[model samples]
Target chain A: MSSCEFESLEKCLESHLPEAELTEVKHILFGKETKKLDLPSCALEAASERDFELKGYRFEAVQEQLRQPRRIRVGLIQHRIVLPTDAPILDQINAMHTRVGEIVEVAAMCGVNVVCFQETWTMPFAFCTREKEPWTEFAESAEEGNTTRFCQELAKKYNMVVVSPILEREELHGTLWNTAVVISNSGNVLGKSRKTHIPRIGDFNESTYYMEGNTGHTVFQTQFGKIAVNICYGRHHPLNWFMYSMNGAEIIFNPSATVGALSEPMWPIEARNAAIANHCFTCAINRVGTEHFKSEFTSGDGKKAHHDFGHFYGSSYVAAPDGSRTPGLSRTRDGLLVVEMDLNLNRQISDKWSFKMTGRYAEYAEELTKAVRHDFKPNIMKE
Target chain B: MSSCEFESLEKCLESHLPEAELTEVKHILFGKETKKLDLPSCALEAASERDFELKGYRFEAVQEQLRQPRRIRVGLIQHRIVLPTDAPILDQINAMHTRVGEIVEVAAMCGVNVVCFQETWTMPFAFCTREKEPWTEFAESAEEGNTTRFCQELAKKYNMVVVSPILEREELHGTLWNTAVVISNSGNVLGKSRKTHIPRIGDFNESTYYMEGNTGHTVFQTQFGKIAVNICYGRHHPLNWFMYSMNGAEIIFNPSATVGALSEPMWPIEARNAAIANHCFTCAINRVGTEHFKSEFTSGDGKKAHHDFGHFYGSSYVAAPDGSRTPGLSRTRDGLLVVEMDLNLNRQISDKWSFKMTGRYAEYAEELTKAVRHDFKPNIMKE
Candidate 1:
């Protein structure tokens, strides 16, 4: 494959695959892990391969001194997109795959320990159309999906934990899911979390395509950090975040595809709230810019059919356990935000908040059991 | 009794009470409900017995017209104090009682239908001192406490729903609770909700004072609105908010006594997040200024004994169901924030966000059942 010759992520993939027999190849990496201290540390950056492009990038570091250091450098990539309106589904997938790989390479070069992408990063947010013809073809298997395979190679090559969010297994029928594929630094397919809360409002008629997730809140204990993915609309659910926090997630990524008018006001709130309440680092990622389709569709409102789903303002930011946040990325620009801080901040913050120990989880669980009763009796009164 | 000598709401009370045996007295209001065709209209302000103070006041009207307007004006009052440290318990109680009554007058004059005072709004936040003797004397009955009677009179006087959060029923045995007394607009004692989440960290050793709530999340269908109070520390628990929302709380008041350094950062987050998630208007009230105690105590740290907790930082604000927020009250001054908007905004925002309809509650209920299981396994992978 020729290096540095491609204009987009799709062209980068064409050099690696002949298109017909791509499944015969498995993901493998040749780059060595730059040996450094295994624990989260401020001095964890090591350059095993000195590429000139990579050498110039410096990580945006949080200067919080830790009482007991467990540092992890996390990266979140928010990409603006441009795809020809008439492009085939395969070409679109190839473009996304190549773009994400490039972003991961940049994150790895900046010595990011773990990286996460936005929700359904491979394709445009097409549910607004509600006409489910070609969009269904974008769904692939999590274990051997083209997106997963592409990420696995990058994960192994960079020795970085990768969270690849994609639409999964939908084309065949009755098995579609919005999933986040968690890959270990060594290219092992660790686990996947499905989008638990499917939004069914306005342009987000996601329930038409995907049901609620069957996979419960799963925290992957990767080599870099213990992470969980609360996919897209799941960001609205505090219980979704609480369950992950209960399962001992040090970091939770909310990869969302929300636009300005539908959810912009709510964007800055939910994930940061989850971070503070759960005492964990939270990464909120959104796709940037506008994606217009060749076909226009009706919103059932009798208004003129529109091609775009509004702007997916990609103001991605990471919130620390202490309720501090890194500056948000630009709304209209494609950018990668790297946040370096001590993971032990979780321990300190949790110790201060003491929510896990003080919270009446068992009691709440009991009430919830009663609340879900078939003949629900509300404990409410009126004069 | 000279009627004009009494203050705004207090004078309205004198007309009903006659300064006689008030227990035998059934409250008769001199005011009438000026009903406007509801769908949250700013023109709903109709005064029956208009004092100059009340006539001059108007609700902070939102211009958003409603399809089916169910309008209600909510008020949150935050107060500051420098109670004489050497004063007797009754003196402190009287001091707080008089101060809050004045604030209630302002709220009533503003035509606020529901008013919530800050957490334990009566006395100094003496819990930080950790001294058992004097503070224990402050706890009173949820039903017939001195504070309840004071609020009950005010509630009937102005036909205002009153939520009075207080240190309750602790002078005797183990019956102590951090509770909010809900007074119906008709002066009926609505059911109370104890603080569900008791914090147990640093200076907030509240578990030492009160156990978790047993009343459950109770919503009262008041004459003005369906309301619930999430007392102080319970604000940290989203499930508490969720349960209330499930029970159809249109407006949830979070009366809190949180100080600056310990929880000021979280103040803006928790209630606002709840408002968005639950599709309900949320009122977050906090005590203002610093209150000093006569005695000094250790925080269990090696530091010397301290005379006061940190600043209360009264930044009480109202968050709309649409994720918009009322500007917060001053951090260092006593202030009352009046939020007047359409109650049907909940219906509109919920229709837009549809988190209630689209969110997979039952699915989550089933999963949470297993999640709280003793033998639950985390979906995690490790090397």
Candidate 2:
């Protein structure tokens, strides 16, 4: 296969190959062991043929004779938009649908019970440009949008839950929101979670397009497991991750589209820290490649006008409640990271750590309530 | 100097030697640049002679020229107790004071405005045995304990703010609390912050010794900077870190004594995540050496009873608000980490990320208030 000059052939081959063909990779987080899973030959071959990347890993819970282990396979897909930003909206959407379809088929072969796509996967990340004409055209209904309909079909076909992050246009009011629409395996729309936090940093003037989400931290209980979505910039807020876990989410997905220049170093840390702090599995996915816009835009930060956002480093990975995490996808490739997790590990870790028992939420609730008041005084000691 | 059979000579020599003798280490977090600082020859020579590890790094804000640079050097000392667990309380305390004094002299030579030691630095970690006789004997008054008095003297001598974590015996009630006393440069006790969260994991039955902290998140405003302490296990809770930042702490110290078998991986990620989330500086210090007690103890797990807690794993490091951090001290050595920070960078990063603006704390405050209620229903959106 012909590769981009920017892509490393060695990394491409490693993700495309079956685990058996690769060298052994052992992972230990706080002493919990993680093992890699070799994908089926059919899935590997499909990935090779389609020129997309696929890898799998497994996390297990200690065997308890009293209860059966609850195992679930989750897939996180990170990809670039198939077409250019200047392409016709429908054409770009359709091309993305087709590309994602091929990858979803491989996930089905790998027996992934749930799958998630990168943030606003069907469109070029045009929020940086701040022009509302063509970009707003990309927004659609959260319930009945074309992307949701497509994901519903894929979910039913594969018997897998699907989380699709898209720019949603409130049908009656014409309001735009960054939303993740969840579809169950039975092909029904479960619910939608909007991005709770909006970014105003660098070229990401996301507030210009959408306001903060009104829907609170929503954990969806599906056929496979309990899950929630913390979209993009919401990962920076620790309480955003905390509320979802408090809502009984077993797996929280952070589907983000952050660039390397802006947030790559943080990519590996935040979600993993969330998993450790909250006693739940966290999946962090970022988009790959750069998207050049039709017109030059200035970030207002004294830099020369540029046409493209910095590289959207795709290092999608999964972190377990025990702090063990799967190796991420290539920074320069479109890849699917499939992780098989024993859901019981969440309870096992919680039982072991007792974070919930020890977390002084009520104390902080009172503190925060007071802090928001005008007459509140912080406990600052000065000698 | 003769080294332990387990430690590498190369690793030992690196920390003992000055920055000029070692390779350069550059840190970048979310695009912020961090530079290493060279220590004075006198301090380097003292480190080599006294044989304790020392290293320094610096973080800077963009040259705004609007305000003078708020440059401050903070030091974190992670050390092993000089005397064994079986040693007399007074003797052990005296020996610890002497060893830490030598380290503080080096820190003073490096121009550290503030310095903190590991959890209960004056005593061997004896909570694992759940013994009260000799261990409770180590507990002293929070306001005028022996450890606090020694720290006050050092603080006055170096004109440095001192944070000393100790087992505090409340005078009125005679209750024991794990606390950190903050001493001002003028040798006055500013205040004390206690370990808000107690661990019950593995060998840490800290509840057997002390209850949760009564002091709210206390930020001590000294002459150099505003600082706070999150003693040991409190680092696992993100809100604990958030509360300190909310109280206007520019730098937070996590004086910890965690073992490798249970928390090596989390050691690096948690404090760094707190810095990124809180838009502040965090110095995480963990004690070196495995302290063997005279008596064996069982963790109630299926494992055999043991005498020592697993390796303390000293890899102490400092993290900046922008996510950059210095190289940590060796895992098997007692060391002091000195980080030169631009306190203005805290405001710079907060302004840049806009985390505080978008945090939506009032929303979570309401959510947490509801969550602590008896009849509260979580926002679980299940089909």
Candidate 3:
């Protein structure tokens, strides 16, 4: 039996553990549910009929799209969770839900059609600890999780597609996954995709928590556009992005939670490479502020793991297919980046580059066809 | 049998056309032999067991390599051939040859063990004209051509490996190939690799000149390191870079003659991505200055071609496996950029990232095995 008794999640963890009735979150916070947001008026440049601009970051040189422009307003939220280690995981998540509600209300006012959060946004990143007892409390089913329910309410209220990246899912009998769930604007449960690539280097020993994703490059169709989610580490794989493009993704969202030292220099690079190579718009989101844990740990390299894991560097930016980029959001502060792009730019850039016309997929198909055999050798020079 | 009989080349290109014997280039420059170089003392930062620095660009934060730092000094030369369009092709080539000898001597004095010249270093990029009369005269046999012989003498004298990209080889059979001949440090021919990808867009209508490469990814072994050349257009393909990495190429050089408007925006991007993704060093070289032809042509985009194509933008650069890059050479001036790197950085980065270990080749093989089927359908979500 588990030590804590909170909700159905506690029961889901064990067949023999005692269960407790779930509390209604709205019943706990009655007055704060409808709280109004007070923010800068022109902070958001909505995707209305006329062209718009904001102070810090603005787009440049809009080219004509092949088809009529399918304009959509997208909001990428970067937030850092603050909670004590000993605090109940349920209450910690509740605090995050309240903050997200405040941001989503403001995004609705700015007319955002879709919003995405950083990887495993609902809980703190505890994979570095390699401890299972405390972290397992955060995992919930995609269908009945508290986060899925919270996002569904916001989706219906604001008529926006919400891409809620959370630590989800069932283990392959004994493992957990870093997953992202897509909720449609109509409050329907659209599908979910897992993180295909896992990192095992210093500070990012993610294989301790989740294995490779089982989902094969899934994209969702909402009211606004065809979109795909390439979670954190998968951004390193070009073919991962190409699969989404072959499936016809106009916009790709890479929700990541990486620190400064591990990849700050590369933050501006990988996604932009994907946008150029795949001829699609890419939104790269990263969490802000420094994350600290209760105890120091070792990084498996005999070095002591400090309490703080560096700054998240929340410099979220959007890149178009034609290589044009919007100025990044503030690197130090919490930010909600709202970007507007004509979806037709995807088709136009693809037409001009002629990559699909001449990609010679047949050639790659033949090469990969031979590569999949169990005895396949990658180095042909030796053969 | 031929209109011009200047040398052995005239006999090779003549059937029924009026001919003249080709002139021996060494004979034309009667007294002008190979000159020695006079440079500063610190210009040659040889990998002689000491850390060094140079003007224009320097490396940042050198990490300890997994093995001994297998440092090699490499130089990439970006030079433009200058002469009037009506000038004889033979004389124009001789001018380029004289200038190259001077630059190469300087490179050798600087302790550069391996050097690469820009695409078709001895000839004009006349593909923009779409007219084929004079450009065909630049074709030569890779086995015993004049360019090959000139590079052989330089290689033997300097004890350096030379990669000479040229308009080679089959004008007799009504076809021309964009090829690069690799001459060993001992001056022996070390095979060749043809350009794989062909461009058909505006300004880069190279389909008029060559067929796709019949040779697979070929890497040459030299005293300094194993090297491969991905001739200009192949840089756009990530798979091409991956192939070279799989074949064990430590340094891959891309020799190109692209203008500013078409690919300048992409210049800083693709090569860096290849270096990071493949865990290898990449050297990118492009010709400088604008070349003009006597006749105007059409781009097939309904726009008539002007006398000059856009600027070649000679910003040659080198990128390390860890994503550190040397400052690019001058965009408008001819330059020779020499870079020093530890070959063991490749193994260290690969070990740290472990992409090859966890890349799930069996998984990708299964996916690609299915993807290559003629009736394979991409995963698309319908509304």
Q: Give the TM-score of candidate 2.
A: 0.94
What lDDT is reached at residue A187 by model 2? 94
Which CAPRI tier for candidate 3?
incorrect
DockQ of 3: 0.14
Q: Model 2 over residues A94-146: C-alpha lDDT tens digits?
A: 99999999999999999999999999888999888989888999998989888
Q: Give per-residue CA lDDT, model 2, range B1-383, as digits (tens).
A: 11122342224334433342222111112224456699999998998898888888888887677898889999999888899888888999999999999999999999999999999888998998888988988999989887888888999999999999999999899799999999999999999998999997766779999999999998998888889999889999999999999989999999999875457667778999999999999999999888999989897788999898777878788888887777678767788888998899898989999898899989998998998887878787667
- DockQ each: 0.23, 0.46, 0.14
Ten-residue stretch with the least lDDT total in model 3 chain A: A23-32
The local lDDT score (0 to 100) that residue A305 gets in candidate 1 is 83
The prediction achieving the highest lDDT against the true structure is: 2
* Each candidate: RMSD: 13.9, 4.3, 16.0
Candidate 1 chain A minimal-lDDT segment of 10 residues: A24-33
Error of 1 at B307 (Å): 2.0
- Ten residues in sequence with the least summed lDDT for candidate 1 chain B: B23-32
Candidate 1, CAPRI quality class derived from DockQ: acceptable
Q: How do all the candidates rank in terms of DockQ, highest first?
A: 2, 1, 3
What residue pairs clash in candidate 2, if any at all? none
- Which consecutive 10 residues in model 2 chain B have the weakest lDDT in total? B21-30
Best by TM-score: 2
Relative to the true interface, what fraction of contacts does candidate 1 keep? 0.53
